[model samples]
Target: MANIKSAKKRIKVTLVRTERNKAIRSKVKTAIKKVESAVAASDKQLAQANLKNAVVEITKAASKGVYHKNNASRKVARLSKAVDSINA
Candidate 1:
């Protein structure tokens, strides 16, 4: 239990932020998984579509500071490679 009012408020704010972050991360993970599954199944069209969605989600995450820009770019590159392999 927080004894001070400020401490209590901080705890509440932290909880809210945690919940939001979790939701964003979950969405990102699901999007990534959808793309990965399509890649694994060798479905080029579906993988490309899912890859776009994944890139959008990842970029949003990066903009939100959940991930570094370099990390986001790396992930996007990997996904692009997967899509290319499908095309090849």
Candidate 2:
């Protein structure tokens, strides 16, 4: 219920940004899950590939401001550790 033009515009912009960020976050989560699942399956090739994909996705999310740099790094680190622990 923004009556002012500026306030209305701001609300619209915020909504658009939120939706875009949500999509990016969802994609990042899905990529991470795929990597984890591959690791759990103990498929070295798939795990390695998926890990690479997850890392890329996470880095991109960080760059895009969806996640803090350190937070994204931590997530990537954990995901990699999981994949590394899997026996091929």
Candidate 3:
């Protein structure tokens, strides 16, 4: 437990930020999984749709600092590739 008031406030802030980050990451993971499932099922249109959603979620996460920009780009690239494979 934090003894000082400022330290207690910092602890509360940290908890809030942690929870927000966790939620954002969870959303990104779910988006990725949706795209992957669509790809696995060979549903081209669905994959494309889910790819857009995944990209949005990933970019949002990156912007919020939950993920690095390059990491987000890589995730988008991999998902795009998987979706493209469904077309080919």
Candidate 4:
């Protein structure tokens, strides 16, 4: 328990931010999974569509500070590669 008024407020803020971040992370994970599943199924069109959505989600997450820019870029690169493999 926080004794000081500011400490209590800080605790509350931390809890709120944690929940928000968790939701955002879950969304990003879902987007990634969708792309992966499409790739695994060898559905080129579906994979391409899902890859676009995944990239958008990843970029948004990075912009929101939930993910580092390099990390997001890596994810996007990997997904793009997978989609490209399907094309080839």
Candidate 5:
């Protein structure tokens, strides 16, 4: 219950931002899961493909402030390591 008109607008903006952030986070999780599953299946090609997608999504999230830059870097590094291990 916002008494002021500005407060009401702020509430609406917050709601929209919340939904957008949730969608971004969901996409990041799904991308990570896809990479993990590909790794678990021991499919290097598939893993690499998924890793690429995951990295893109993660970096995008980071750029948008959904994730910290360091956090996104770590995720991409870990995924890359897993894919590398598959080849090694």
Candidate 6:
């Protein structure tokens, strides 16, 4: 319902950005889940591997503005802690 041309363009851009953000968010969630599942299975090596991947994905998301820097840091910290606990 955007009558102005600029408004129409903005709406289109918004939709595209929304989809992109959703995909990034989904990827982040999947990565986090993988780490959690590996930890739950009590496989330290698998958990460590998944933790590395999850950290990468989270950092990328934060850099891309999908997540706040502190939020991403917190997530990585918690995941790392879980993996470390397995080793202890």
TM-score, structure 4 vs. true: 0.97
Ranking by TM-score: 6, 4, 3, 2, 5, 1
Weakest lDDT window of 10 consecutive positions for candidate 1: 79-88
Quote the positional error of residue 32 for candidate 3 in Å: 0.4
Q: Candidate 1 residues 1-88, lDDT tens each? A: 9999999999999999899889888988999899999999999989989998999999999999888999989989988998899758
Worst lDDT run of 10 residues, candidate 6, spans: 79-88
Choose 1 or 5, whichever is better by TM-score: 5
TM-score, predicted candidate 2 vs. hidden true structure: 0.95
Error of 4 at 25 (Å): 0.5
Model 6 clash pairs? none
- How many angstroms is residue 30 displaced in model 5 relative to the true structure, after the best TM-score fit? 0.6
Cα lDDT tens digits for candidate 2, 51-85: 89889989999999999999999999998888878
Per-model TM-score versus the true fold: 0.92, 0.95, 0.96, 0.97, 0.95, 0.97
Candidate 6's residue-wise lDDT over 1-88, tens digit each? 9899999999999999999999999999999999999999899999999999999999999999999999999999999999999958
How do the residues 1-88 of candidate 3 rate in per-residue lDDT, one tens digit apiece?
8799999999999999999999999999999999999999999999999999999999999999999999999999999989988858
C-alpha-based local distance difference test score of model 1: 0.92
> Mind sharing the TM-score for model 1?
0.92
Candidate 3 residues lying further than 4 Å off, grouped into runs, are none
Model 3 clashing residue pairs (backbone)? none
Cα lDDT computed for each candidate against the true fold: 0.92, 0.91, 0.96, 0.94, 0.95, 0.95
Off by over 4 Å in 2: none
How many Å off is the CA of 60 in candidate 6?
A: 0.5
* Candidate 2 residue-wise lDDT at 52: 91
Prediction-by-prediction clash tally: 0, 0, 0, 0, 0, 0
